[model samples]
Target: MTTVQATFDSVDPATGEVVGTHPIAGPEEVQAAVDRARPAADWWASLGFAGRAERLGRWKAALTRRAHELADVVHAETGKPHADAMLEIILAIDHTAWAAKHARKVLGPHRRSPGLLMANHAATVEYQPLGVVGVIGPWNYPVFTPMGSIAYALAAGNAVVFKPSEYTPAVGRWLADSFAEVVPEQPVFQVVTGLGATGAALCASGVAKIAFTGSPGTGKKIMAACAETLTPVLIEAGGKDALLVDADADIDAAADAAVWGGFSNAGQTCVGVERVYVHERVYDEFVAKVVEKAREVKPGTQIGPITMPAQLDIIRRHIDDAVARGGKALTGGTVGARFVEPTVLVDVPEDAAAVREETFGPTLTVAKVRDMDEAIAKANDTTYGLGGTVFSKSRGMELARRLRSGMVAVNSVISFAGVPSLPFGGSGDSGFGRIHGPEGLREFGRPKAIARQRFRAPLVLTTFARTAKVDERVEKLIKLLHGR
Candidate 1:
């Protein structure tokens, strides 16, 4: 028997030792995988909506039953708290179930509009499935991020070829295995493990569409590559999201949300609160409350280690730059071996890298704005528009709508992520296309429009034998209906 050797080591951040090893798939292996997937995809797509939904339900049951085990794998690889891992799993399962239950309603046949000129024709539109979809997932929120694309695509009747981040290949393999157990008759979903090269190979492969979740820099590169083949893509890139606190906002509640949003999962969240804008009237009070909350939260005790050790340097540099540029740190401002101290800064300069760039760590910068309008301007200045929160007693909804983003929460943070009915995605530099709700179901399917002529037209304008008198009468009728 031939055995594949592990190409990379999976290190436990809490410790420094290797927990497990994952096989690295080369270019040839990737091509072979895609080749094998073609027929399987056809077979899976042939199973109509009901058949696919039944298989998806079985897969959901398996995942729900083994949720803890999968969460453990996530914790081992990402160094997030077990509770945080469980939350991700629960959201992933919820999205999977929603995708299966809502696919038909979202993609089923529907009557389309017939123009006044084509009143004798009947028109209809239906969503057709894409062939095979390629999903390149991220390490942070491994379960939630990938499933946003995978489950939606699968439920839309497309096979998925997943390339999980190298750091968490085990979790990806676990997901694929569970799915296989539910749909053993067809290789409907598969996993190919490796690093950047593996991901590039998947992109170059002839998949119908590619869904990539990662940094903006990497997302740009993926988009450029996909353009070569004219293949459609959906990107869920990183964010420098903000939380604006109005003058009448509850300081304690805003402070609590800031702490959780900025430090949870060690601030590895894409929608984490990296920047904050506060009204000058209550800025001092809000700062005090935030500092109090920051003091209560500490690394390795309240939060876990930085899953990616290299991120520690970026976090430290952002803090240093903020302080060097006249910003003040009211709390922790240091980096440890595997963790970053919970840090909060006030009066950070707008142009500083800490404010301009994305620092995916447990650090936040707060600024005092004159009023809500200024708060909205500063919040919209960033290139990212993923997710944001607004904390205001009266202006919550109005402020939430003013921010240019895909999802916004009123008086709360990240609540939109929990709502299964809302679409989850972003606009502007954050990327386009959706991966949740009805939009997500249609994302994996193509719109097919059908038109049939039901009866002969009274004027018979389509035929070449139409006389000038008939054309003049038709023009007069159009002008009469639309106004001269």
Candidate 2:
């Protein structure tokens, strides 16, 4: 049997050995994969909502049945805890279900005002499928994150070509393969496994839209590449999200949330709480509680190894820079061979790299602010606006609305992901466009307005043969409507 050499090996990180090998597809192969999707897209779009919904139902059932197997793949590849992986899969299933169930209502035809002069014409708007969608996924939360785009696009009647994070290509393949089992008629969904080059290829391949989730720097490059073809894009980039604690907030609850939000998935989440701004009155108490809670969490016991080995150096740099700049490491600030200590640094300079940049590891920097205004200002200072959390008894909703983020949790952290009705994306350097909710469904489809003539108008404006009398009547009607 002929064999292809491995592209890259998936290491156990804790052991640093090759756990599996994945194929790295080149540009030509990537283009071929996208090209193969055209016919499938036509057929898939032809099926409309009912057909797509039925197939999605079957896919959901398959995913529910094989949830454990998929979770194992996720854990093996990303090194997250099994329970965490299960949580990610379950949330992904929820998003998939929401997309399937709501696509029709969200994308269906709706009545629109025709204006006074055009009252003789009936107008309506509906969302039409964009044919093929390209989803470039991230390794962190491999299932949950990518499914945000995959499920919505499929629900909107678009065929999808997913480029999973190179580290977790197996999980992507598993998903596509499972979908194929349900809809064997065509390649309505496909996976192209490779590195950044494959992702760039997809951006340049003329897909109607590309949904990307990664770092801000990479997101810029992806947006630029997509612009070459005028292809629209939805970018869920990195975030230096903050969790603000009010004077009357529950310090213990805030501490618990901060620890989990910061350390879970080895701190690889874009919406991970990397910074905290507490009211000065409760600063000392909040700091003590957070440190105590953070101490209870340890790398490899509560968290997992850094999935991508190179991120270790970045994490180390952030910690070292904070410490060198007179920041104090309250709990863990050390790096192991493949694992990073769950570091919580306080008294860090505001300009420290740890406070200003994305560490992408198990670390957080907390600061004290005089009031909610200062807290809001500090939280909005960063260019990222992916997600944030606010812990305030009297001002939870108010603070959440004031934060310049895509999604905000009032009393909790990461609850927006569970709602499935709220849109998820970011602003500024965090990137634009949305995923999840109705906005996500519309992102994969194009608006199509259909207008028909219901009766003969008193004044004929569309035809060139209109007489002076008709023109005068139209002018009179416009004046009567606008009172000009």
Candidate 3:
């Protein structure tokens, strides 16, 4: 009997326009993609470092030649401004180039020093690709976030099967199609579009590893699904990131960073500043500056509509909850059908959901702290520790070290994310593992250690022919060398 296929619509959140219709990519289709990746991984790996790098360069050129086209797809699906979409693409292209340029150096065999016990042996180590990687990407930053894993995985000689966020499948498809233009003979990178069940199918599809980016609750569910097969997973989950402004910080710069970090792309960024802690001495000044700057920018003009309709309800609820519990809206708190004006709240309870949970909206709660110690404490109090920003002149680095988040920016906002040399991920509830930089390249590969003997020892201890006297002498030598 012929079975029917399932499909879904990709709607433009801003206008409710049907952007496209995509096949639901059920378990069978997902598995087929993985099956294709296995052979593709072999073929791509056979190309070695030089060949793959050359092809990747072509892929990068293709993306560069038509960057605006891909960005258009991103805007249609996510409702983010075209410029913001281009920014995401630019970062992603830079990361892709970095991966292709550094893959050989990062994953190639490197000489290692043999220990004293094995002085006659030469040691070496290299990173080998894990065959096939399944990536579940996010919708907010459709191009950049998944490319962190995708580009690195391909550079490391592994094939990729990506499940783009159901909300932004067309963006993912565009990326894959452009890549196919370079490596048309093989499916080095493929996209499987669908909802959560499709992602779950990829998780259980026997891929070498699964890289997921989404909320912690969904992360937990993905983890559970992967656990059934003992499949290793890397999760870049939701974050309740904070920005701290010290007494001596440049209030103008701080306010600008806070506004951009808090409301950019409708504040759906995983590393966006959801909370702000200001020194009590300058709290009022910081609030005034932030309010003044926020009021100047209007949603739908400067910012774009919320991409997910369901998230609108959540944003409204969080704002309502903050106001109901003694919180004051400093500026821009009204929520429209598809857009939420930039909101800055003061006097919000520390325990309120708006402050404690991951609002993931264009909203921020500012709190006054007695000192930097209290600021640090309050910033690290959340269960989520992903990325954070700090605007301090004197103690930027010193204070950054105290925060529990994985990546911290001192005197700037989300700058670490753009630097190709810096690793990006999170700690605690934000999930584990990393993507980007050296850590990202290594994430897609496994280390293989090798030892080759240059010369045979006159008296080998590993053999059973060794006498007890030799064993006794070795024990004495170990005791003399190690005993304190």
User: How high is each candidate's TM-score?
Assistant: 0.97, 0.97, 0.98
On the 0 to 100 scale, the lDDT of residue 127 in model 3 is: 99
Task: Order candidates by TM-score, high to low.
Answer: 3, 2, 1
| Candidate 3: residue 20 lDDT (0-100) | 100
Candidate with maximal TM-score? 3
Model 2, residue 458: C-alpha shift (Å): 1.0
Q: Compose the digit string of candidate 1's lDDT tens values, residues 172-274.
A: 9999999998889878889999988898888889899999999887888888888899989999888889999999998889989998999898889988899
Candidate 1 TM-score to native: 0.97
CA shift of 38, model 3, Å: 0.8
List candidate 2 segments past 4 Å from native. 1-6
RMSD per candidate (Å) reads: 1.7, 1.6, 1.1
lDDT tens readout by residue for model 3, 357-472: 89888999999999999999999998998999988999999999999999999999999999998999998899999999988999999999999999996557889899988888
Residue by residue across 61-137, what tens digits does model 2's lDDT show? 99999999999888888888888999999999999999999999999999899998788989999999998899999
lDDT of 3: 0.93
Instruction: Please list the residue runs of candidate 1 whose C-alpha ends up more than 4 Å from where it truly belongs after superposition.
Output: 1-6
